[model samples]
Target chain A: MKVAQILKTCTRRAVLAAGLALGSAVSATAEEVFVYNWADYFPPELFDKFTEETGIRVRLDVYQSNEELAAKLQAGGTGYDVIVPGDYMVQQLAQQGLLQEIDFKTLENFPNVEGPLKFPVFDPERLYSAPYLHGSTGISYDSEKVGELEESWSVFFDPDPALSGQIVALDDELEMYKAAAMYLDIDYCTEDPAEATRILELLEAQKPHLLMYSSGGSIERMAAREVPMHHHWANGPFRVREEAPSWRMLFPKEGVNLWADNFAIPVGAQNVEGAKAFINFMLEPENIAAATNFNGYANSIPASRDFIDESVVNDRGIYPGEDIETRYVGNRLCSVEARDLRNRVWTRVRS
Target chain B: MSNRSAHSYLAIGLPLLALAFLFFGPLLAILAASFTERAPNGGIDWSGPVFDAYTALFYTPDLFGELEPNRAFLSAFSRSLYLATCTTLICLVAAIPMAIYISRRSERTKTLLLLLITIPFWANLLARNYAWILILRANGLLDSALQSIWPGFEGTGLLYSETAILIGLVYSFLPFMVLPIFASAERFDWDLVSASRDLGASVSRTYGKVVLPLLTPGILAGSILVFIPSMGNFITPQLLGGGQDFMLGNLIALQFGASRNWAHGAAIAVGLMIGISLVLLCLRRLGPKGPHLSGGA
Candidate 1:
């Protein structure tokens, strides 16, 4: 009985010691900056750079889709210090009071930000968000598959029986409906239920021609020659073209949709200063260049363009020409009526 | 003995109660939400009880749009049912011989065979699916082998087809069928078959009348286990069938994911549950009447 008591006392001391050590470790690592960003958006090397410079441990999480990131922030489970939301979502989040207004003076390389990004529609005075990456959504096709370029969206949405099951379109409802609206020359943000019905009709007419609906990875399918043409995001096709030269990213004569992803601090962040520091660090020319090259997406940092290859910086696909720019529409968070119309159209499309 | 029995009941009941509270409570919440209108800002509106979500089910006009014909919840439901039935049939055909072979093995060999059947379960399902892709893709091993054997052979590109999805389903669920069939077959009386044969009964007739009846329990158990999950699976259809082969699970997932329509998703889920329950009821009604027949049979 005495021997057992002695052993139990020793075990108790060990457990207490272990508990104390763990408590101290938790306290020591309490001040951490949590960032949620798009998958492959950041260069892995930057994590090391940020940590080395700031001495503040940065915990990074990744999301595959903008909707997923928004849902996470909206649900209020993730205590993320920083988040990268797309242009329209940034406005939505800011309006919802989910984001903190950013102080521009704190950003040392703020002057180097490009003119296009300086006063974006989402953040007119650059209050809440700083532009990270921008791209366009358009048709991507195999040049070798179809001899001459098909400039119009009608190529994929051809009502002809011959083109049945030869084309693919984006699975995203908003983008798909918007493309239909643009093709029909209607207001992209139409609140009319009739317009939604018309868009649905157009989609249904195009249904027989479509092989499949895909998002994000549609370009890879096109590169593999699984589908002849696809409605794809600009950067995706560009990334694929690096491997498959025959693949071409096209700005449809109808119009292209422009989108930008921006970095912002969430409202209830524990390490707000650390988040600001990380954002500033990312805006550095070399850092942004590395990130842009890694993701194959256009960076909004003008100073970063100087560091990037001239070919990429000047590429009409990445940086649209004036004529192409005139045709492109920056997506904005629609009013409730438009949002309802979008959902209704999307439901009809998916249904 | 009575005290011990009461203690055992308490032990089991307490955990079950806790589990019910934790799991069923949330499920009930979701079910309640499905009956209400969704708020404009993507939340439960909770204004008043309404059947709008259910009415949304018959809104077939949306079917014509960019959405694929087979991607709607109804079509997906039908597809899942068809796929599950096909999977169950395939499992039944494949497992019978394998289970028979396993049951007839020596004690040591039976253990080894059972272990071999279970070894694949150790690997992640995603990894196994990827492995199938590697073997089945156009530039994959099967294509390369075919190309070498016949120089002019053309590729079928079957990896992302319905055939591939069915193959994946059967492969994954085959073991579930096999284990129970093996259990039934191992306990079967070999002397009955011998007696039937000795009485001038043909091998096929004797097996059909004797062995088949005995194996019904295993067959029923295996089919139910395989069919239930296969009917609700999203991953198998997504990875193997690709986007073209949308299933009910995929549609329900989309409602929760991109669509953010939890009420609609819940309504669909409730519909699926009702369908499953009806199927179970039908199965029960058709079950063998005699106590001589096992519960699973």
Candidate 2:
């Protein structure tokens, strides 16, 4: 009886100690800047480095897509310090007044940003959103498997019988829809019902050959030789280079979609000062270059180019020249009607 | 009330209260949302109740008089039902023997076997699904093994197929089916089993007449456990079948995410709930007249 009573007392004390420790830990983390971003979009070590430099610790949450980020914010009271949004999403958020204007004067590295990125159509004034990384959707393939394929988008749309069950397109409604519309020589964002019908018909025709619907994962799949050809993003070659050096990405003769991911402080961000410091830290040349190296995407910091890998710099797929740039089209904020129609069609395609 | 009566009330009342708060409270909220119109950009429309979303579940009723059938919705619903039936059937085939074998084992061996069944649960479901992808992709382990065996055989790996999806569903839900049936098997009257065998009955007749009636409650419980989740599952199909084989879960996810139609999503969710209840009612009607057990997995 005496031993059991003593053991119970010890257990009670241990529980109290643990509860106190957990309470303090929660309070300690409350001082941190909470950054919400895309999954695998940055090296996690960067946050540790930031904490090492600054007194403030950083907390991270990741999301898979911009739609998810938007939905979370729209739901209200997200408690996020900073969020990353793609260009079209930024436009939507800014229009809704869900974003805060960034004070560029506080950041010493603001001038290091490229002139083109500073003038994105979403935030033309560059007040609400800061550019992070940019890339374009195109074709990436295992050269070992695919040989002498056509340079046109038809290679993916109307694929060779040999390439059937080996091709993948982005599962995203807009990206693949744009690719299909561009391949048909129709406007990428046309409102015409006939063009929409044509796009749906095109998607249906291509459905049998596609191995999967995916936004990313093509690089690893290519490395694994699970997929021979992918209607994928330009940044994929850089990612797959180390693992599968034979993998190559190309700009199709048909136009490709250009996209930029940017940083935005939501309206109710609790740690504006910490968020600004974090953003400034990320904009620094070495830090931005580190992000680019880790993610295999192009950073907006122009001065960071000197620190980029030689292969990434040399690859035409990663940094397309003027010829390819002229062919790239960016998406605008889509009307709900058009979005709904496309979703309905996509549902049909998948089902 | 007297202390004995009060204690009995406390025993039942606490669990009922928890059930009401945890399950029915949120279900009611979703039910309310299903009646409201969807806001312009995916939020709830608080203006008023609207039955339009519920009607839209089966028909467009738009400018175009295309009321023949909502092909997308119908296909997704039918596929979900088909997949669920397949998963339940497969689980029944696999779990019945597993449960029986485990029940007949020595206590220590039975514990070990049960532990082995539960071992898969220790690993995360998503991680397990990803591991499946590695084993089943092109030139993956299965393909290579086949290639080595038959030099002329061209190997087609099973990723992004109905077969892969079924494998995932069966592998994940088999344990659920096993546990409940094992409980039922534990209480199985051995004397009756022997008498039926000795009586002029064949093996099949012995099972049908003597064993099956008692196993009905367990079989129903296990089927319910396997079928419901499989019917609404998207992850197994998404990762293993590459989101190519869409199901009810994918359709619901689309309504909430891509389609941005929360009202429609909620309506579909509620509709699925009703469908499940109806299915349970039908099953009960077909069930044998016996002492029904309330064991759930």
Candidate 3:
């Protein structure tokens, strides 16, 4: 009985000590900033560079989509210092009071932003978010396999019999619908159910030819030449070209999706100062250029072009010419009725 | 005795409260949300007690603003049921002989065989599924093997097909079927088989009348274990079947995902739960009346 009593007292004291240690560990966040971003968006070395330049340490986490990021923030107490949101999500998150209003104009390198991207529709005054990387969605194919096909969405939507079961499109509903609408030359986010039916007909017709509706692992898929023709984003083709030089990224005659992911500070961030410092650090031409070189995506700073690799900067797919620039269609948040109608259409197509 | 009775109440009460908080709490929340309305920008709207989500499952407002019978969710549901049934039946057929063989082995050999059967589980399911993709894709392992013998073979035509999805589902759930039947087979009386044969019963009659009836409880439990999860699985279909062959699990997930309709997702989940419960109830009534027939593995 005496030994058991002593053992019980010892365990109780050990538990108290462990609990105290964990409490202190959690509270010891004087120099770390937690960033939530898309997977493979930023290089790991950049965080090390930030830590070397500034005294702040960096902790990073990744998410798959903006919806997941927004949902996490909405649940509250995320403890994220920085978050990367896509174009429309920036506005939605801001309106929902999930983001903090950080004045980017006060940052030293804020003026380096390109004039066109500076006042984006998502954040007009640029008080909440800053553009990180921008890209467009289009068709990617191997020249060796398909032999220089015409640059049109029809090649994918109405594929040749020989090219059947050799195509892939993004799994996202909104982006796919937008591409179809662009191909059909109809307005997107329309309340008209007939327009949605038109999109569904096009999707259902193309489903037989599609190998899959997946967005992840496009770089590896393209590099391996697993699928001859892939509906992909701009950056993926650039990486694919590094392995297979014969690959071509085509900006279809129909308008393509032009999107930018932005950096913003979420509410309840523990390290606001660190987050602001990291944002300002990323704004420099040389730093953002290094990111573009690694991820194969273009940065918003126009002057970063000089620091970018010659192949990437000169490639029309990554940096399109003036004629193709006008065909960029930015994503818009759809109305409730339109969204429901599209959801029903999407169900029908997939079913 | 009174003091011991107080201790018993404490033991049971604490566990029951924990179960209520951890299990039934979320279940009740999902049931309640199924009756609510979806807000414009997603999330649940607490202001409504509507049945629109349930009704929307069978009917849709067409482009002409008229009500039409919607076959989308129903088709996906039927496809899921078909796949789950196929998976359960295939697992059952493949596991019976294997289980009997293992049960007849020596104790040490039985342990090793059981370990080997469970080896696939050490790797993550996602990684295993992706490995299947590499082995089944065009110019992959299967294609290359066939090409060595028949140079005309260009593609396997297995990846992103219904057959590929079935292979994946069977591979994933086969172990669930094996372990349960093995348990029953281990407990089975071999002397009864000997006696029946000595009493002039034929081979089929002896095995059928003696063996199968004893294995029914385990077989029923195994079917439940494999079927319920297979009905709700989206990963195997998404990875192997290319997301083209839609299933009920994927449909429910889409509502919460790109569709941004939580009420519909919750309603579908509630409906699935009810359906599964009814199935279990029916199985319990029809199954033999001795063993507990608990589901696991």
Candidate 4:
């Protein structure tokens, strides 16, 4: 009867308000989960399916960047039941006591997780987070324009004369600096000013060739033939493939930064039970496969592979070979000193 | 008298409370945060007051605590000032004739022309900026249109340059300049112009000496409105200028967003506010008094 009452209030409120912008009054007695994740990450119909099956009303909000999500949680009282933070952020949030232990190992679908993803460097014991989607950052270029270039960072760092004013890179400091560091064979988390200066020099040289440094509109911009080469992520090429079949995404010889987004409940979540149920539901092979098919990113659940779209599963951009797998290295949680150096380098590069 | 005083207090008290809560509250918080240090985890460390953030604007501390002269933020600030100044000057030159022309029209025509000026505002600013990209990019609409006229012509590719940013800024803020000058020009007396001409004054002298002095107040107000916002604008530069160079607003955003140095961001904001306030004070002192416009009435 009590469970029924909770479901009744949740569904009734969901019908009235579409389960959005109302998180406070019914929070004490409702079976509702608020999901905050990256933009364009989840299929819209998946939420309805989730609510239908579990009777736990799902409300979704999206954020543009990991820092924004961290900032919101840091400000406190977000009323968010579940948050999707990237790899290093999970460790940071867990260390700051902003995340509660989820004991994901006890979950029924724990066995579905990929072996390597089970003990991620960020959350070794699966204590505070569950792996959601995983991907890597690399170059996505129009082969027709670039004309058979080597699969190396040099294509971006030392752009050809023909490619001048037709290349672009991400505006993010971390991703940009990481790519530079990899190209220069320097440490990504180096606090050394000399090393940072070297990275800055490389970026400054590339700056003139770049049309812009933007993180948004990669797919649309590429589709419109705005740039021949765009520093992009794995999922970007898949989305761009339909529009620009001549374009190709590649991992450079140096390396690429591998990232994993994980689902973790914040400390003061209103409906932890509902949040847990949602996470468990998402862990299902069929459900997460739908997310992969929709967003064109790989999920951590290995069993979901069979359910993935053939175009995505077979795409080299999404699933690179074993030899190139070594190039997908995990990102480091840079020290405060190192982060300061990186920020200064970015400012100088932009200036 | 006591009842009147009580009513006056009630009238002023509510607005004052609202101002304090809405304006001063956040302003004071930012001011306080500017003087604080950054925690290890990228948020403000409110343990104590420090000038590290302000110092960081000019000098970056090395591993040994020695300060290195940093020109990054200084360059961004100067670039923002340069762009804003250019936008204001261009807008002033372009808006004066347009405003004067609008003010001289029939009453209904004047209203219609002003309506036409504001029709662009009905569309979203972001969408308009994106449209500018479509027009300004290489081999884009402009190039295609030009190519139709001259088959061999190639586009210079204006899209991601400072020129494009200037074009976007001037286009966005021109109405701010026009409306204020129009308001002043609408009140101009035609008799002064005829009197100057009757006295055998040259056309240039009559216009320069009579028309310019009366429009100072409107020009000052318009300049302030256009210059201040354009100086701190990040979107136009990010979209049109390709974000290769960081403007003042973009630099502040970098400090807050990726840099995760809220104190530094707050410090830059406070510094920008102070700089703009000083500029406004100078402009006020330089502007003609209300009596300068009395001849118009």
Tell me, by lDDT, which candidate is best.
Answer: 4
TM-score (chain A) of candidate 4? 0.90
The list of candidate 1 runs beyond 4 A from truth reads: A1-30, A103-108, A159-166, A216-227, A314-316, B1-18, B47-49, B58-71, B289-297
> Per-residue CA lDDT of candidate 1, range A175-227, in tens?
78888988888887787777777887898778756666666345446556666
Residue A334 Cα positional deviation in candidate 4, in Å, after optimal superposition: 1.4
TM-score, cand. 4: 0.93
Best by TM-score: 4
Clashing pairs in 1: A348-B62, A349-B67, B217-B297
lDDT tens digits, residue span A158-232, model 4: 988998878988888888999999999999899788898899889988998898898766677888877888999
Candidate 4 chain B: minimum summed lDDT over ten consecutive residues — where?
B288-297
Arranged by DockQ with the best first, the candidates are: 3, 2, 4, 1
* TM-score (0 to 1) of chain B for each candidate: 0.89, 0.90, 0.92, 0.92
Better candidate by TM-score, 1 or 4? 4
Model 4 bad stretches (over 4 Å): A1-30, B1-14, B62-65, B290-297
| Poorly placed runs, candidate 3 (over 4 Å) | A1-29, B1-18, B63-65, B290-292, B295-297
Per-prediction TM-score to the true structure, in the order listed: 0.86, 0.89, 0.91, 0.93
Writing each residue's lDDT as its tens digit, candidate 1 over B142-215 gives: 88899999887776577767898898999888899999888889999899999999999999999899898888
User: lDDT of all predictions, in order shown?
Assistant: 0.75, 0.79, 0.83, 0.84
Interface RMSD of the candidates, in order: 9.5, 8.4, 8.4, 7.2
Please give, for residues A1-351, the per-residue lDDT of candidate 2 as tens digits: 012223334554465446545545755744678888876567756876887688666666667667778889988898899899998899888887899988554467788787567777778877887778888988888888889877788999998899897788777887888888889998755656677778888999999999888654555676676778887778776766778888787777878788999888999999998998888888988888888877778777878988988877777777777788787787678776666566666777878
lDDT of 2 by residue, B149-223 (tens): 988767776888889999999988999899988888878887888898888889889888877777777888898
* Best of the two (1, 2) by TM-score: 2
**Tens-digit per-residue lDDT, B175-286, candidate 3:** 9999998988888888999999999999899878998888887788889989999999888888888888888888888877777678888988998889899999888888
